[model samples]
Target: MDDNDEDNERFVRLLRQVFRFLHLVLHVLAGVFLTAILVGLQRRATDPSYRSLKRWWLHRVVKIIGGQVSVYGEPAPVGSLLASNHVSWLDIPLLGGQTELTFLSKSEVKDWPVLGWLAAKSGTLFIERGKRDGAKGASECIAKRLEQQERVLMFPEGTTSDNKNTLPFHARLFAAAVTAQAPIQPVAIHYLNMQGQTHPLVPYLTPQTLMQNLWAILAEPKILIEVHFLASIDSQSVPRKALATYTEQQIRLALRLNSA
Candidate 1:
């Protein structure tokens, strides 16, 4: 590319980022009004009166972030355990917005600037990432939610991966479904660009600051995330280990991502 071309691209990205950033700030400010206050950090996430507020609030956040969610296949019935492949931090809001279900999140997310406050206000269950020691406690918490007839989604991969890879599923999480006897709904999430290929800018990877990835998403003019809900599995019948493997295969197949 010529020097002028590179300069123009930079200018465009800067302009886009500024415009979107202003909109985001205004949206956050809007949270003060009563209607918006319903989505406040103090609101009860599981309150029946505001059941859809969390989902609606999430949809707006994803929209502002330039993510357009497209769903394929039906989401499993309410109270089913939704299992999906992890991709980006955006996955939380993107997936949660479309499905009226609570999901597990990184414990640290509650401390993120604005998004942290938002996630904490939603029906989110927090877990410390990569601590096997906490797995049992996390699973037990998830089981309790499931037993309460709440739809709880979890990323069995336990961590995010680049679009080219699908990490092996951690069987420990599937135990939640077994304990609760809830059905497992396998979900596949894909971030596709305008060309329908995996979006290079959206994946969350090490060494890349979250601010950098967030800027890239905001600067882009278009975004598409496909959420495919696969067939439901009977957690009651299969052992958690088998349940984890099968659910992972379903998500990998739906995303059409080759194993690394």
Candidate 2:
């Protein structure tokens, strides 16, 4: 390559490295802030103070990550079910940063560090797999939450995947919405890279080492997270199976992600 071309390449590389360094520093500060908020919330779970602090902390985290989340349609009623396709662990704070809905996650997540603690304190529901009655019990619990006018965000894919394709929504969870007569609100989340290109880094994680994966993500400059809320399906109109199928379809269409 010519001298000028080489110089330009070097400059771009330097800029990316500098941005990465800044990103890392910001992440450290955000983590400290999130932890402090979660701990404080834990101490005062019975009062409204915890929710207030959590909202502020989450908003700050969203700003720190340069993540711009846009809600497409009007939010459903307070007791409505907010369902979405699972992309990555980042979906927690990314979505939670927008709204204060409790998440329904796999039981394994309860073993995670600060995240697990925060989720638990925030009243997240953890489902244990490999148990016959687990689904039924969890559904009942979700129904109870809905009846109390609390929003529950569930990923019916049963596992996270690259947002490029949508997974089949687990029909079991929809039963809770059916029993509670709560509407199901579909949402789509997409991640764009620095050049505005779609990158798999959004849902990038593996069974081997989630921590290492998260660290690598922390080292990156930025990832754009989009949360698109779709139309709500009235429980009286759509059956559980139909609700699951329709939601999966709408989410795929909204984000142009595959739902195969």
Candidate 3:
């Protein structure tokens, strides 16, 4: 590109940021107000009722950010285990909106100020990776959730990475799927702009500067995230480790994402 192109890009980014900033404020206010109502409603909500409200809230937030989410293939069974590549925190809203699934996240997320509180309120499962017993407990909790016919999203890769690279998946979490005899639906999430450009805005958020993080999201031009739900694999088909590798490859192929 030329200087004019650079300038145009900068202008577009700036416009997006301003809009995002306004949207962010609206979302915060909406979250606070809606959360209070949800808390009250949860008291009288059946399991299915709670999932419906959660899905609606997630969809509204993703829309506010000007992100479009698309999913392929049929939704796996209600309680099927979903294993997907971790790209960014946005995965929360993207995945949350598309499916009525609970997530298994690291223990630290439980301590985050607002985000953490929201995850817990929304039925996220926090796992202590450092303790072996904790993992077992998490697996048990996941199984129970499946028994309730609620899907559970697990990022066996353990952490998020740049949009271009997917990390190796750790198979230990697969134990839960095996125990529950749940079909594992491997999913790939891709972020691209209208021109098929991979914008860093998709996976730029980190733990630092919560304000800046929110700003980065609000400042981006419209983002498009594609979620491909691949074929479901039976956990009992092979060893858990082998299943992990196969699932990883299938998702990478489905999204055309390269791995580090």
Candidate 4:
């Protein structure tokens, strides 16, 4: 490459980093300001629910980040359980920005210092893997919530993938939806770049840390996040393992067709 090309590339990288850092500052400031407003709201005789507040804050943050979200399918109503393919940490905001969603995250996330605190405050349920009792308890809690007609999102794959294709789902997580007899809708999330390919910066693959992926997204000038809400499967009719397999296949097919 010529010296001019090298200089241009460096300049672009610098500009991207600067913009990302600015976005981070704005996100944090918005959180603090929202917290203060919430405190005052709590004192009043009547106020909006914390659930609504969270939804609004997340939605506003997505707007501040700037981009067009291409939603292909309709979101199932509030009472249904959302079964989606896991992509990146950004998936939380992208999904939450659309509608009120509470998800079950790994127990490790519950100990990540400030991030842990924020995750818990946002109503994330921490599930400990391999602990039968803990898993049972979580399932019960999820069932209770669904019974109350609250929406819960579960990433049955149990880990993040390349976002190009979906990993097989863990059937255990689908038990609660079955127990509650709630409908399970397979949701697909994709982060696309300017060239119509998977966003180069968004995947949380090996050797790439969470912060790195996040900063990469902030550096990019534009990105498109696609959300597809596939048909809902009736948890009442499908057995646990069948339900899990079907949901996974649905998402995989969605991404495959879109890429084609």
TM-score of every model versus the real structure = 0.90, 0.81, 0.87, 0.88
Computed on alpha carbons, the lDDT of every model, listed in order, comes to: 0.82, 0.75, 0.80, 0.78
How do the residues 52-75 of candidate 4 rate in per-residue lDDT, one tens digit apiece? 767776776555554458998887
- Candidate 1: minimum summed lDDT over ten consecutive residues — where? 31-40
Candidate 3 residue 240 C-alpha distance from true site, Å: 1.1
How many backbone clashes are present in model 3? 2
Least accurate stretch of 10 residues (summed lDDT) in model 3?
41-50
Candidate 3 lDDT by residue in tens digits, 1-260? 99999999988978887876787678767775776676876542336666787788778778877787777886687879999888777788788888788888999988987778777877888999789698789989998888777789998878777787788998887888888888899998888887877667667435645466657776665788888988999887567898899899999888775654
Tell me the deviation in Å of residue 86 in model 4: 0.6
Report model 3's TM-score to 2 decimal places. 0.87
Cand. 1 Cα-lDDT: 0.82
Select the stronger candidate by lDDT from 2 and 3: 3
In candidate 4, clashing pairs total 0
Q: For model 2, how does the per-residue alpha-carbon lDDT over 1-260 read when each residue is reduced to its tens digit?
A: 99999998777656665665576467656655765765765554324566665656666555654466655666666798999888777777777767667679888878887667766766789898878988888999999999988888899988887767776788888999999999899988887777877665557546637655554555456677777878888877567898889888998989875556
What is the alpha-carbon lDDT for the whole of candidate 2? 0.75
Which regions of candidate 2 fall more than 4 Å away from where they truly are?
Answer: 1-46, 258-260
User: Candidate 3 clashing pairs?
Assistant: 17-219, 20-218
lDDT of 3 at 239: 79
